[model samples]
Target: MTSTALTDDMALRIGLAARALPDTSPARLLAVLADCIGLPPNAEKLDTLSIKQLRSGASGELADCDHSVLKTALAYLNGTASTESMPPPVPQSPLINASGSDPEGTIRVAIASNNGDLLDGHFGSCERFLVYQVSADQFRLIDCREIDDRQAEDDKNSYRAGLIADCQLLYVVSIGGPAAAKVVKRDIHPIKIPDGGAAPALIGELQQIIGAKTPPWLAKIMGQPAESRVRFKARALEE
Candidate 1:
């Protein structure tokens, strides 16, 4: 990756990791990380670093920092932090009061989640999938599919894909190539959220895209009429 891209990606990870360290700002974490791993931090470097290295690097200004928080910070940086260490879950809102009735033009979305109502889970490691039926005007939580430990031990990625087989879209903080292939084979589009956040906000953004001008790929997935697809294509070409 380009230096700018690496720095930007590292910046997002540092921000999340910093949250784990009490009173530690992203800038402070970045400086400490740089001291430990060298300048221009990248994900590959951070993934290889250990808690011991971070503690050893925490000197001068951070010499007196808590070790527990440092370990938590490293876990967050590596995307291995447990749900308990993550930010509190957001409550599910606008959950469907009625079942088996979906609005026209709606698509089912599976959000990889470790904490409540947040798109903070990786495809392989997230605790559950929060399923939502989303349309241009509204969205409602339809189900939450918990991962089965037994299945995880054997062919986990395929098992996970089976859990959300009905969903047209899959949102995850990160997904490995093999896992992504499985999802795609099931006709589910996988969207990676580098900096995960509240599920509602992300779905709202998707709603906007659907309402305004659906992309060609999305249009196809939504099964828009041929004329509608042509119109969308024309509009996109005009831009």
Candidate 2:
């Protein structure tokens, strides 16, 4: 088989894995895999996949594939590739608080909801604020809001700053393109929330795994914590 054919086959397998996951983006999938493999945040380099390598089945460890097509597939999956060519560096800050009293330790998150309904229906009711606490046993919920509202203007900047600001992290619920663009422009890490069912559950599970708290609003909507379900696997794209 030619390198292109091998890549195509691998990509097909990975794509199939992704399709099994509902409301998951390739970027998010890649991020999950990267985290699992302990790869660096800036290691996504899939766009460089060549036709020669795709035809022959990947030999040895899948590291090359991991470094190339998988990374590219992730960028394509997350919808962040067009605006910025490279994946943003992972924020060097604590995603949660150690002490609720320490202002510096608080995980200041900006929940951007595209419409009031999604905010109201899915995120508003969850008791997810506890996930940000310093102690694993304790939890609390912070404020949640719509990005376009009157009060949100100032908060938006604050939220953007928090993503890169020392000890803060940003959480995005259902907002899209323009909003994502604004956040990314600030060099903040923006996590897109998946839709209902297993996706939300999977997110919650990952949050726990990462030792970060889920938003109180998200917890409430999810009702019950779901298992870890990876929607896609990295594969070299066909030439």
Question: Which structure among the candidates has the greatest TM-score?
Answer: 1
- Residue-level lDDT of model 2, residues 1-239, one tens digit each, is 32323244334434532432322344544445443432332223333433233222223222322232333334443333332212212223333445534433223333322222122111221212212322223233333322222333555444433333322334533334554466556544456544422222333444563323444433322232343111111111211
lDDT (10s digit) by residue, model 1, range 42-99: 7677788877777667474444434544555677787676524344343254333366
Model 2: residues with Cα > 4 Å off, grouped in runs: 1-106, 113-136, 145-167, 196-207, 211-239
Residue 225 in model 1: lDDT = 85
Quote model 2's TM-score. 0.28
lDDT of 2 at 71: 36
Candidate 1 residue 54 Cα shift, in angstroms, is: 9.8
Can you list the residue pairs that collide in candidate 1?
none
Instruction: State TM-scores per candidate.
Output: 0.63, 0.28
